[model samples]
Target: MKRITLPLTDEQISTLKAGDSVLLSGTMITGRDAAHKRLFELIQNGEKLPVDIKDETIYYVGPAPAKPGYAVGPAGPTSSYRMDKYAPALLDMGLKGMVGKGRRSDEVIDAIVRNHAVYFCAIGGAAALIAKSIKKTEPICYEDLGTESVRRYYVEDFPCIVAIDCEGNNIYMSASDISAPI
Candidate 1:
């Protein structure tokens, strides 16, 4: 499987197409409902966000606490559409990727096309299985945000799909039509 880091450049996005299987490694930030809400407010006010998003990929998750020596607890993807409103704004800031389940609004999809970003989705509720791939986790900021807080994960070969490409194409939204679950 191919491995990539975030802030996917035009070259990377251009090379990626639907059905491309990848394992994302590097710093992936976790944010769900609570964090997404806070991020929206930060964007509207032109305030500095808790983390630098230059080329960051946000993971929509709230993992369980890690066991001793484990990088993180059960890690799983959450409903991605929840952050639809905030996604467009962040995309404007050079955020090139998002990971979650479910379809977001057309506005979010349009913003993605306009900004040349893609969406990656992880297997939902498969936290323990997913956590096996994480090598480390560190609280970068937003410590008090609870599990909804933003944390950085250094994952090794975390399985993923290029659900949405720069061309404004998506799979999960139409997975029911094109492909059956593997």
Candidate 2:
């Protein structure tokens, strides 16, 4: 139950594993379905993106609007699989981590392993609770994309479980499959 924060580098990320607790800071871009589609198309057509993927963490969250005195609204991890199709390409470009809920494709897992990346899952159904961890947020591009638009967040000890690791380890499956006491 230790805490680790970011601007973490490859060596730091490569060393992480499932079950590790993390508090990520720095720039993590938000992208769900629509944004992912646009990013994929851009990559395919060799178009430039607003931000580089190198050693970046992609959070699978589309937060609600911020209320007064808040930098962002209720923000929490969304389903991970929705972004699966576009994940491999991002990982190939040096995406080192992701934040979301549930499982992902084997291809995505393989991409994580092959590219030395990891996936973290936040507590689902806890948007309000999670929002408190976010110190601030702002849009980067694709503003018309709504909350799915790329943005940056400054978080303070945002909690998460490292569900997948660079070596292909995953925690969610094991957690779900644990036998109940008879």
Candidate 3:
């Protein structure tokens, strides 16, 4: 497994390849559809975003409320396609990486390549297991969105697979390219 530091540098991102298993450490922000829409709108209106995304990673998640002695609860990736509409803009804004589950749109994949970004896939249904990696969770913006609110998480050895590398090689596409009939 490759160990990656967060806010990935250009060299680090370039070195990653689709299908690489990675253990990431450092700060990653969480956001799902609601938060993405709000951020997209803000960008559309030429307003400053609540957080600077340059060199930062955004995890597409909406975690359950923490139980006692936990940093977060049931933290898992949401479907990446739902955020595809807004992802390009975020990439354009210097967002370096994204973490989520499932396939992404062609446009979104293209944007990732153009922006020199990487897309990771967190295991679905591994929520409780994943939360153990989180060391800190703090609200950052859009508190009214409740569970969908944006938050910053400090993580240690958070597990992921490189679903789409900076060069635009996509694991999902490889799966789709399989010609054998099941």
Candidate with best TM-score: 3
lDDT tens digits, residue span 1-182, model 3: 99999879999998999999999999999899999999999999999999888889999998888888877889999999999999999999999999999999999999999999999999998999999999998989999999999899999999999999999998885465788887
lDDT tens digits, residues 58-91, model 2? 8888999888887788888899998999999988
Model 2 stretches astray by more than 4 angstroms: 174-182
Residue-by-residue lDDT tens digits, candidate 1, 120-152: 878788889999988888887777978989888
Clashing pairs in 1: 7-55, 75-127
Q: Count backbone clashes in candidate 3.
A: 0
Per TM-score, what order, best first?
Answer: 3, 2, 1
Q: After superposition on all CA atoms, what RMSD does each candidate show versus the true structure?
A: 3.4, 2.6, 1.5
**Once model 3 is optimally superposed onto the true structure by TM-score, how far is the C-alpha of residue 167 displaced, in angstroms?**
0.4
What TM value does model 1 have? 0.90
Look at candidate 1 and tell me the lDDT of residue 26. 74
Which residue pairs clash in candidate 2? none
> What TM-score fits each model?
0.90, 0.91, 0.96
